[model samples]
Target: MRFLQNLLSFKQPSVMRRIDIALIVAVIPHLPYLSGFILAFLFVSVIVIIYIKKVSKSLVNTFMVIGLLLIFISFYGELNYAGISRFSVFISLISAMLIYVVMLQRLSGRVNFYLLFSPALLLILSFFFYNTIPMLLYMIFAIFTFSTMLLWSVMEVNLGIVLKKSLSLFLLSLPIVLILFLLFPRVSFERASYGFTNDQMMRTSHDGTMSIGSDALLVPSQRIVMEILFDKKIPPASKLYFRGSTLYSKKAGVWKQIPQKMLHFKALQKRGEKTSYKVTLYPTFKKYIYTLDYSQRALEASKITDDHILLADKNTEKVKHYKATSYLDYINAEKLSAIKRESALDFNATDYPQLYTLAKALQDTSTNKSLLNLITYFKQSQLIYSLKPEIDENSPEESFLFKYKKGYCVHYASTFTLLSRALGIPSRVVTGYKSNREYVYKNYLIVRESDAHAWVELYLDGAWKRYDPTAYATSSDLLPKENQFLNDLSINYLYLKHIIENWVLEYTRDKQLNILKKLLEDSMFAFTFTFYVLSFIAIVLLAGLYFRRDKQVHPTQKIIDKLLKKLNKRGYKKDKDEDINTFLTAIDLAQIQEINTLYHKIRYARSSSTDEVKKLNKLIKGISSKNPKYP
Candidate 1:
């Protein structure tokens, strides 16, 4: 019973508080990606740790119970989503045990050896979740804190000295770390994507299908979806229709993409000036790749479908970068194949009779006039645009056109395509993203989930032309106008994310090979430049050595050295090769004995509450020849 009491009452060492702080800092980088269960646990755990002593024991117990429940819930949730993998389970168990030890520290104040390694593990695991410049910087800071704990345990130096040495060690090792990173054999992205979160499979926007009038769906997210950099100035927001996928078949108020085996790769006729750009896409774990309107050709990493949709050969859940050339004004095809025409025109008139009659009534002498009249009809409908449109799902198109008269982009696109088919004008729905008025990042456009949109493509005058029906609606629902300053910050973050993603997160063997090939092409020039840089660095270092001053000893050590010489001059002098402690012991002078002890304490202790120099001065003034106490 006494042993139990002693164990529970044991206090933590000085490094424990810093360890807690480092763990908290490590969790910040994951806040944007973590699930609510994990975030809640972290938030509550932080509170318990911060106010552990201030709060009563009952409150601490309550917090502990809640944190444990959350951990169990999160563990089970991860297992279900990630499936039965032994490695995953083992890592999860290790993480749980670490957290449990940390919690016990708050409750019992017992020193935990397990926590000595926890901060470093947290930083390593954070790499698997996010790889960005800001995250890398925070990890470095956390590393310094971890280094302090290790240095303190072994060296037992002063606090300032410990910090300085930690910094020097990290700086000395940085070059080797970079060399290993550059030379390491990286696994292919498809085989070794970092995470196992199931959210990648569930795209929050542009899922290649639409059923707008169904029960209320997931709330829209404002998180960034893609960041695009154009070689030229970005086009107006009205012209930024970055297509991701195309949908054709429809039944029971749902529009879906039906793969056309007969419609093979076909070239798009370029109309206006071609613009080239790079796109950095966030993970959707889907095959569809986003491209600007009327992509000129297949991207290097993907294939172009008949509808000009870019399709990656395989799915991935990592941030992807690709270059594409596109013309905002272009003809999808001069001649539509029979298979595509059938796909575009196949719609049941009986299912939406009201919309079909409306389509026939709006027909005119020419296809152009018919399309114009259809646009005017929509403009006059006085329909409001909303995310959650109150309409019947059974006959969504008919209900939207004749009764409810209100819906968002998906509803407008679906209704228009059905009506155009009814009027003998072949049409298909395109699902993608569009940037409205907002601040651009330099020349790049940062597209978000809020930019997800749907539009229609009509066969007009021997070409499939773009038509957005939502443009005619009265005030569509949109995210509120964000502050310009906040938007600029977001844009800045994307700039850094892109910079790091290409160099580190997405660095592959193919990129390295390409770099080496370029280097070989310019071998002579590269060798000359390298020689000049090295010569310059050597000169600067030599110049520094020529003029730099010698180093000095510590202030406290100087004072003690002065006192030891004075003591030697008096009759208390020493033997040959005698240490300071041995000389003090042999003389047995009680007055100055404390001076020797204080100096060594200053040199050896890990941390000191009072100034070692101040204590030494106090002892010196009274015990030395100048003191009034001896007189």
Candidate 2:
């Protein structure tokens, strides 16, 4: 019990209280992504102050001013902007000023008020940076700690009691806070648009570019760019080609795509096996919106390009939720025009002579025959699937196909597209993500950036069909083992992350309305929601009643009354009009005088010292012994 009491103790020295306030303020401005330098500075500064055993108020004030100037200069770049960065810097500056006020000033009514208000301000500022459940709990704790400190500065009371009162007050205020938050107005926008702030904050792992020969080594990434919640079961790994864009032009082994006019091509609607799904895409700062094989219609606030790629009107700087319907065996049955066919088949013969020679040898009279021959030719080769493939920069195509015969999906896709174009079979390189490791957690599918993939789309038999030559190679050997403990742990982490995102970060006004609409659609849900709201109100009312119950008598008053009863029993009946001094004079005893002094200090001066109470108890016993009739 003693150890537990000590563990819950809240007593601290004067300088330690100031340091605690400073440290709490220091932590608030850097949430979600705090800088290491600032954290180290706060710790080191507090430690040095404690070890020195003395604090010169003037010296502390001077250093505070210097710190403010240095902070301003350090964030001068952010100050020039009109975004979240600038807002964060402004918040930090305000926090610094408040911390100085709390730490440097001596204990007084004014200082107590400042100390109480600083942590609340910091808590409010924290909402701008993060709004997770953990942050909400931390905010409540900040309030409780500062409130306890405020009470301690003014009243000498047990630490446990102080903590109890502060915690009760915080709990009682929560319902009101929640109500206000729900009814507050929020900014609304229909489309996902990324700004400079988003770029500065969250960077995409792999840039959405389909160029080739840029880097010899391909680094594997595990970042999650998007997650899908399908209306039905997920498709097979072989058919999971999230089409982002198509690269049709090639120059010196580097494939690139020209910007096509938005909404130029009429989407040909052909009924087939289709899967409807909703995507929760993170901020990519790019225009492309990845989808499956073919999408018949564009997502809301987005458009379909001439290359049949879905694109947002602007960059996706926010978490975007959009629905898309994709056909499993989608065949773009629209016959390519003569001009389109020539453009798709056009490639620089001089740039890829070795590929051209191979294409010439493998060409057949028919388009299907030529495509089959090329795919067969690749399968017959000894090329292996590798994460990082070594190729000669000057002759990448020749090195990859003839010498090394080991490259990644990009090499295979680029090589197949070039060879098909050379053999008069129009083809384009498709770059997007492929999900082999699809985790089914509560019906939603989670896919990571390690699934980023590349393939070829050949225009055969008046329809575009997908081909993946890399699938012919041993691609599984290049990736990590499945069903391992780490994989299971990863799935668990993703499940938790999904809950946080859906419940807190992406809970926008539209989503709230959607939730309400769904709740109202079902009788049980409506009843449950209404019941919850009413229960919350009832709880608040009950809490108010608990606080409003009649106050008990003060402990000091009870102790004084017991002493008076003992005196009355001893035949020294106190006059009703006599105060403590008059009663003590009538008694005329040294022990009674001492008891009277202690009683007056406690009852009149509002002191509650345990030592004084003990002395009064001893003095009362002495009086009782002097008069044998005392109770």
Candidate 3:
């Protein structure tokens, strides 16, 4: 009976326990985003105060106030937009205050209840910022640790028992949480006056006009521009040219796209060998879809220009999906009008006399092989391909061709177009993604942002033929060879990333509906899902029951626990960090000293005889009898 009363009694949390709770509740969320200065400051402060003194309640309160002030100042102008930050700040402040309050004052029922449950709020907030798999693993550990601490804070219990109960509670709640998440109605109609509500939702910047002759080097954007889900066959890297826009007007060395009205779109007759695909495009804040070469739009409200480049009907600030079909290993046989031919062949001839002299000589040397001669010249001309290309802004074309000679796909494309036009061959620059390499998952091909490329297209044999001079540039030792191991690691990382994004993060309402439809179609899958869910629930309940069974305790441990409880009721509460000897010494109690000596033998020296257990229990009973209120 005395043991039962001791087991159910409340106790003050130790200094270490209070600090642990405060640190977790106040600091963990900000860990990922904390500055180096703040971390160093904290480290220095900890070292300075290590053995000087115990943690002061005043110090904790001061820090809490400072944190609150910083939060307010940081979010001064953006309070409306900083709702999440505000929530985190408030929780941290309350947790810190409660922890310090516990240290200085007696644990009132209200205060104890709030302290017990406040950390749970931090756990919920954790999900808002970090819902990734790694964070999920961390959360499991955190939930167990904090919940165990909470259990210990409120009641006098064995450490192992506290751990077991915490685990049981967490597991028991998991099934119900999952059930609620699945069955919860997320979509709702806002209002009705015959008016129902509708549901709604930079990953990359692809909207900027792809200017031709700018001396500024192209920065490689690894930010994903879009993802492609090929309906059928995935195109090879050599052939995957995602045509965006065609630049026809060239003046002052810079090439610009002709106005929308100036370009013409002819119907594509070669649909027999078409490859159908869907594009899940990231927001570029522009309408450009960056569709495949010779692409024809298959979805409504999608636009395809004469250049075979697809676009959304409106600017998209969010992810938008569209379907299109593109022909592979086929020429765009649409004959260019005389005006279009002139536009394609147009360039500033007066500006490039040196280039024209070279072009005319090549044209004269090989009349029938002008295009091939020009391509061979580019291949033979030791021009380096790089992200950071050096070209004089005043003479970008001349400097790129004759002087610097090092450039990216843009340089290769622009120079090749100028040379082709100089030779009177109809040519223009096409800027889009060259999504050659891709991760193939579940019959879908994934293309990322690094594939953004520019190339030239020349009119040959009554059809526009794609000429990738950048491929020629790569054939030369311009760029350093990629480390095979690093490349493979990167590919694997991307593959895993796309898997997570598609199956986890991007699993939308539509995907859920499709999954349900499939489950309905297959009775076996539905049955399997239902059976697993029910089994999970049953297993959770059984596990909880198993863990809830009476935990076996050593007789010596029981005696020590009873003694601690009796002392607590008599206003000689032992510090949680205090060992049996230290606590007894602090109390200066002769009776506790005898129990402490016996406990040490059983706990440390392996002396657990029945006589020792009875003796320790006898000492505990004497203490309890003297302090009857404790009993």
lDDT winner: 1
Instruction: Supply the TM-score for candidate 1.
Output: 0.66
Error of 2 at 300 (Å): 4.4
TM-score of 2: 0.72
TM-score of 3: 0.63
Off by over 4 Å in 1: 1-87, 90-135, 146-156, 172-195, 198-202, 215-218, 262-264, 272-274, 296-303, 313-321, 346-357, 393-395, 398-404, 437-439, 477-479, 520-631
> What lDDT tens digits, residue by residue, belong to model 1 across residues 1-631?
9875454333333666666666676555546555477667666666766675565667667767876776677667455645445554545555555555555555555457666566667667666654456666777787777776567666544455555566666655555566566666666643235454523333465567776656424466777788888898998887899998888897656678877432355666666898888887778778788888878577766777767788888774666678888888766665777777898899777777788788889998987788888889999989888777777868877787778787888889988988888888999999999888474777868888877889999988788888899988877665567797887897787677666766775677877656566667888866985676556555554544443323325557677666666666565566678877787766656766777787777767645435677888777655555543442
Positional deviation of residue 113's Cα in model 2 after best superposition, in angstroms: 2.6
lDDT (tens digit, per residue) of candidate 3 on 1-631: 8776565342446745554465455447644543343444344444534543554656555644554455455445545656535654444334333333432222121245555455565566445445354565667677677767767666454555676677778888878886765555445322111111111126454543555455445556556676676767677778788877788876655667765531245665574577887776766677777767776543467766666766677877656666677776566776677778889988676877878888987885553588778878877887777666676776676777789877778778877888888988889888778865644554455566667777888887787888888887633333564787776677666557656655555555666666678788989999998999899999988998788777656446766777677677777777778666887776665666666777788676643565776777776777653755432
Which pairs of residues collide in candidate 3?
none
Q: Which stretches of candidate 3 lie over 4 Å from their true place?
A: 1-27, 30-116, 122-184, 188-214, 218-234, 261-267, 270-287, 298-302, 312-341, 361-369, 376-405, 436-450, 460-463, 474-483, 522-631
Residue-pair clashes per candidate:
0, 1, 0
Enumerate residue pairs that collide in model 1.
none
Q: Which candidate is the best by TM-score?
A: 2
TM-score of each: 0.66, 0.72, 0.63
For all candidates in order, the CA lDDT equals: 0.71, 0.68, 0.64
